[model samples]
Target: MADERLIAALDFHTMEDVQKLVAELGDSVSYYKVGMELFYSVGAPVVTWLRQQGKDVFLDLKLHDIPNTAAGGICSLMRLGATMLNVHASGGYTMMKTAVDRMHAEADKMGIKCPKLIAVTVLTSINQEDWEGLGQAIQIKSAVVRYAKLAKKAGLDGVVASAQEAALIREACGDDFLIVTPGIRPAGSDTNDQSRVVTPAEALSNGASHLVVGRPIYAADNPVLAAENIIKEMENVK
Candidate 1:
């Protein structure tokens, strides 16, 4: 059951690869993430195909631009029917709020279900040094709390965080607020570029509403079995 929260990252190079991976993963995963690389390469067709399959999608574009332009992007992508989408919290309050407001207006005008709008607080790739290098005075946890608060104020549904920070976010943002965490690594897997990694169960236990896993599943010897094992692992967290 916890497997339902697992969002498979379709970071593949081609649609053929995505279809093969999806076939391998099957109904075991109901959600997928389409980031810049894949989306730019194939455009909206992958989103179209995923919608056709009745799969929920997380459009991880991390849009960051002027208020009007970002809002325009959000509205355009929501029309593609992704169930979840995001903007960069670093984009500042006006940009994030404008995206939320205008997208809501567009959705209302079209009478379509509004997609979940989340914000990326801090990428799992960076650590404290990286944060400081970005010329920020605050530490990682403090910055995440601040950004998460700002995103919420901008009317976002959730924030993209690391499982390691899920508890802090839950404490700061409350239970009703969602925290969709990436950088999930099962036991004995490579950490890749993620600096704040946690197991799926650990993420769940720490108040992550959803988990996003990519390489751990896609790069395994048997992807389908790997997904099943990850689900089993997530179930065992409690």
Candidate 2:
């Protein structure tokens, strides 16, 4: 069986690596995040391939540009058929709203189902020290919450945030707003570059709608088993 909430992050740079991993993971993962590295390497066809395999995609380009440029990018990417896509919440309200409106309008014109647009609140890899180093006055958790609220107000479907802030975002944005949490490490797994990592069960219990897992699954000796174990952990959340 596949777990839709468990989004495997395809961080590989080659199509061969992606194909091999997806084949190995099989039904344990029903969703995937095709981030900038993979997308830049393999291009839109990777998204097409994922859809062909009956898997949902979160196209993680994290578009951040001027209003018109970002909206144009969204309109273009929407044709790739990803289940979800996102912009940077820091792109501000008008940019986010313009992207959302244009995306919906483009989908309507094309007669295709619009991808659920989201916003990146803050990278999960940024911790307190890193945040403070950037000369940011507000705390990381507070900033994440503010971004989540701004995203919702801008008409986005939700946000890409750390599971650590899931409970807060849920409280502020309500139950329906999607909080796609990355930096998910299973118990005893290495955190790697993710600074705000959480266990699968903890993320779900903290109100994360989806969990994007990378190293714990893909970097494991047996990727399929790792993914299944994480899925089991997610299923056990209560």
Candidate 3:
């Protein structure tokens, strides 16, 4: 199914809203990202509930802390059975490696599916000018490439980045390493807060293993139809 490549960004406030969307979209979208906002509000139960509903959950916590803390957090998050987990690539190789090693160890012991250990190279909302404001001389592409390498060295399965940088990441990290691209906007949709955005087709064609579409699908007038259309666009590229 086309939705296999589509991850619906469930940026809702309440679990009720999550349920409503799940019932509405049905299996057209199986992967749902429970990001920081919703995660903070609902917690691990939400991840459990999503799995109970037969959906794959991408726990987008973007954990970034000391290696020990991050590893502990990964172990806890793993118990919840998330399909994917992410940490900040900027957390350095040690932190990311710590998460990966701990996650694998815990998953093996628990005998459950080990979540894809991914890293966030850079948030899609960060643009060149915005980056410059941070007083960093590193170019956006340079930073993404650097982060991708760090993620690879850390033994991560992939990196979350903009599709605009998907090819660069793919070339650097190789084909097996996952590239889940967020900040995806269908043609003519509002850019919203994302400084870097691309259409579903463009993202898939550029080597994105999956697309995380939030506003474009969830915020649409007819969410199911919108999601279906986007999925069509995603499949046609292949």
- Measured against the true structure, the TM-scores of the candidates, in listed sequence, are 0.97, 0.98, 0.98
lDDT of 2 at 21: 96
Best by lDDT: 2
Candidate 1 stretches with Cα past 4 Å from truth are: none
Q: What does the lDDT come to for candidate 2?
A: 0.94
- For all candidates in order, the CA lDDT equals 0.91, 0.94, 0.91
- What would the per-residue lDDT of candidate 1 be over residues 109-222, giving only the tens digit for each residue? 999999999999999999989888989897898888888999988899999998888998998888889899999999888998999999888999999999999999889899
Minimum summed lDDT over a 10-residue window in model 2 is located at 229-238
With a 3 Å backbone cut-off (N, CA, C), the pairs that clash in candidate 3 are none
- Using TM-score, rank the candidates from best to worst: 2, 3, 1
1-238: candidate 2 lDDT, tens digit per residue: 7888989999999999999999998888889999999999999999999999999999999999999999999999999999999999999999999999999999999999999999998898898998999999999999999999999998999999999999999999999999999999888888888899989999999999999998888889999988888888888884
lDDT of 2 at 106: 93
Report how far off residue 66 is in candidate 1 (Å).
0.8
Clash pairs for candidate 1: none
Clashing pairs in 2: none
